[model samples]
Target: MIGCRHRLRMDAAHGRELRDVVEDSGVRQRREAAAAHRASVRDTLIAAAPDAWVVIDPELRAGARAEATVRACEAGAQWIWGALLPQEPDTGRRGGSEILMRDTDRGGYIPIIVVNHKVTDPRRPGPADFHPLTSELSRWNPQPDKSRKLRQQPRDQQRLAHLYRMLQRHGLASPSLLGGVIGLQADRILVHDIAGVLDDYDRRYADRIAVVRGQSPTTPAKVPECRQCPWWTRGAEGASCEQWLTERHHVSLVAPGSRAEVLRGHGVTTIEELAAWTGEAPQDWQHGPFDEAVVTARAWLAGAPLVRRFETVRVQRADVEVDVDLESYQEHGAYLWGTLLDGRYRPFLTWDPLPTTDEGRSFGEFWTWLMSVRAAARAAGKTFAAYCYSRTAEDKWLYESAERFAGMPGVPTVEQVREFVDGPEWVDMFQAVTEQFICPNGKGLKKVAPVAGFSWRDPEAGGEASMSWYRLAVGYDGPPDLGQRTRLLEYNEDDVRATLALREWMSPRQPTAHSAVEQVPSLADFALDPRATPARTPAPVTASGGGTLST
Candidate 1:
């Protein structure tokens, strides 16, 4: 009891023991960390080693076997060894090794490396030495005391050797030749005249070449030229026109026989000729046939400026006012309709349903609203305009309901209306539309109005809750009798508002204050001509297994 009254204290002996425990624990932790780090380093080193080649017991004359031999040579392998089995049963108990030599097309005797137990020596054999010559082999061999062989590499690496061999056998053995092959592989150009291309590059880039003597374009000395010419075309005064031929440009010159024959056949000999030939211009010369390509190439070489056609002009942001159109979607099974600016429904002017249709009435309404809204906004003296997001909300909801209504059977009789109103289907549909299109994940008209800087307060009803006109009118579907007339008008009005809003948003974001609209034509229309020539399609191919798909 007397000893317990005082706090316990460790003596020097006890203190030494406690310190020893802590030191030992720390030492254990450090050892584990060091071991882990060493393991990681060892794994990385092993993984970085190149794969080993596995030769067959008996070598084949052609295919992958031949390809691997060539690749090993190109990859800087110094020797080729073949594996052989010991004719004497006591030589190793497992197998033996040997080197192979074969005839090459270049008049030299090339060695083929194989790893097997049996071999018929190409040369008079004497010693049990000699193996494949390779940097990896040198590094791993020379120490006969080592028992294991190098790890075998994957078959894909061997196949890669085959691909390179195929390319080398073909016309692509040099860099210029290689670039042409690459260009063709990338679909950028044709690989014609590979040898000429290589020779051309060799002659041009072989020495120090001066391009221009001075800065002024007035003198031939001022404008420099390239040392190497890929096209091998030359001009007078020690200048080459090859670069001009290759560089892309818009204007094109054609020998009337070459150019006129192609265009006149297609009925586009001149601009007025083109106009009379086809009311609408061609899609684009980029998408044209080889004749157009030749013309374009010639034009660039001759330094002709591109001709501008008014029909190709784009509408600029500053020169003209913008308008937006928005219309609500009204679906009715096979047929769908809308009433522009009103929340009513119409029967005949509606869109078709899916499976038989591309897009819903909603998309069509959006397009119509865009066309009209753009025109109207211009009239209202607004260059950029937008329709509020509320219109999208309304249209989306209506589409969902109309889809549900269409899927139901028979006609909408008196009892059917009551049932439609009270059934689980109606309740679920209503809830889904509310949750998905109306709430937090989505926007109600009231919320987006403020985001777009519209400060107008909405009207509310009842003590239960307050709501805006946009919210209440949303998805009302209108009276069935009116054929969606009111719905269309309401929808379109919203579209116009939203389009106006978008334009306002875009105006401030422009990089410069420059008016883009100044360059556009007021109202240019080009009609499609029936007399235009059609392009020919390539013939389809069918194989024994199946016909291949084409774009």
Candidate 2:
């Protein structure tokens, strides 16, 4: 029987099938059986040596918890088994540990041990969403008496101090342990000794602790969350509230940072205001004090193209180029690595977990085929390049797969994989876009790929939707949907094609400094005009590359 955390993670990856099981009587019986088995084992261990450890179930009542705590304190047990206790309500903060262990009588303190599913390595920090402790640390005040002094210290020092204090408040005098089930065994680490891990986090963040504390106001950042905010609406009914006081407002297209703050400071809070503003432009442009933000905002308001040449790079053309995109379920590994070779769509898929036909096997096949194609190109005295929109996901999966399949037949050497990734043959189109343009819509491939005249076959095709499809395709939730695999493949193929389109649009073959900006069309243009000629429809391209070009 799976734990709630693991079950939830599985449900998230594979849709909401586990949610149904959670309410089922059969599943409840299984869970009860599992719990009983665990309880029996725990009881036997405790009975053998009561002074070694004490157990406190979180499901116990308040009175029972108090009784258990008192009993543990009296037992002279070295370890107290219970979830972290919440702070006093008056403390005005949040954070707790997973376990509490008695310290050796240096100062009669209790040390904390946080149990998480994730493996936290001080050397490599995981994604921002995975680090809940960081968020907790930002809100906690370790030393309320020296709050001013703490705030004055560098943000890094302040963060460390807050973390240190949070642990101390929980009765920990020594370094606390971050324990988790990594792979099959239990892994643990001392928080204070994780070298350079917190430093990396500090460098990545801009001291937003004060903003979180409500001591300072923060300018809106161009993060994924901003798109979902209630204030993000425009022209929709019931959009404006008392705070905004207007329905004509538009969100700024500028990337979050100094320029966005400058715009906000100048009373240009909305796209409508930005389009109308005639004040002095901010001196934030890389080339000059050009009103790029205003221009982009106006373009978005008018539903016009937003493109301008601020910088350019010469991309070497390859004889055989393949635009690649990977789709993976984090809990189950990568299932598909799709490619658009020339105009043809090809996919390397892994649907089974059996050793004979698993993701690792499929990955091995894909690697071999890719390397052979590269060799063929080299033999013909031409170059081969693989274009991927972003390196973060693709590179991560590539290395992970290589490690997972190391020493296996048909798999490439780890060194070979690293060399390919680091080589010039692998082009990161996202990096290319960042070096060339400052898009108000931000640097996401989904945002800019459309600007390059590319469209997905399915209107609903996206990262989240694809994950759901993959779950159904793998039969993780229930009976497999046979059609879901095709949908997943189509989505992956569309992604690669989008990457290809972007690469072509930004290639040196295009005219230099050519802007795609056009005058904003009037609202009447959107309405049917009898005088307008019917738009010509292009022929569809087949999966095997033979077809008339659309672009």
List TM-scores for all candidates, in order.
Answer: 0.18, 0.62
lDDT of 2 by residue, 1-551 (tens): 11122122223333433343323333343355445444544455457667666677778875566456546645555666553343434443333333344545443323333321232323333333222222121111122121111111133333343333454554543443222111101222222322334455343232333333444443323433333233333212333222233234434344343454566676666666665556566655343444555555544544443344443434556889988889876434787888888699989887873223377778888888888889999999998999898788988889878878787656787788889999999999888776665454567887777766677889888775675676678786698887998898888888998887777765734564542221112222222222222122222222213332231
lDDT by residue (1-551, candidate 1, tens digit) is 01100011111112333443333322343354444433443343335542433333245543444455545445544333332322222211222122222213232112222211111112233443433212222122122212222223322122222222233443223232211111101111111223433333333222211111121122111011121211124333333233332242112122222333345456454423332343333443333344333323222222221211232222123433323222322211222332222232223224332323333443344434434644575687755322223234334334443444443332233343344334322212112223222111123333322223433221321111211122233323332334233444444444344334423432333535543222111111112232432222222212113432130
Best by lDDT: 2
* Deviation of model 2 at 480, angstroms: 2.6
Give the least accurate 10-residue stretch of model 2, judged by summed lDDT: 144-153
Off by over 4 Å in 1: 1-48, 51-519, 522-551
What TM-score, to 2 decimals, does candidate 1 have? 0.18
Write down the lDDT of every candidate, Cα atoms only. Answer: 0.29, 0.53
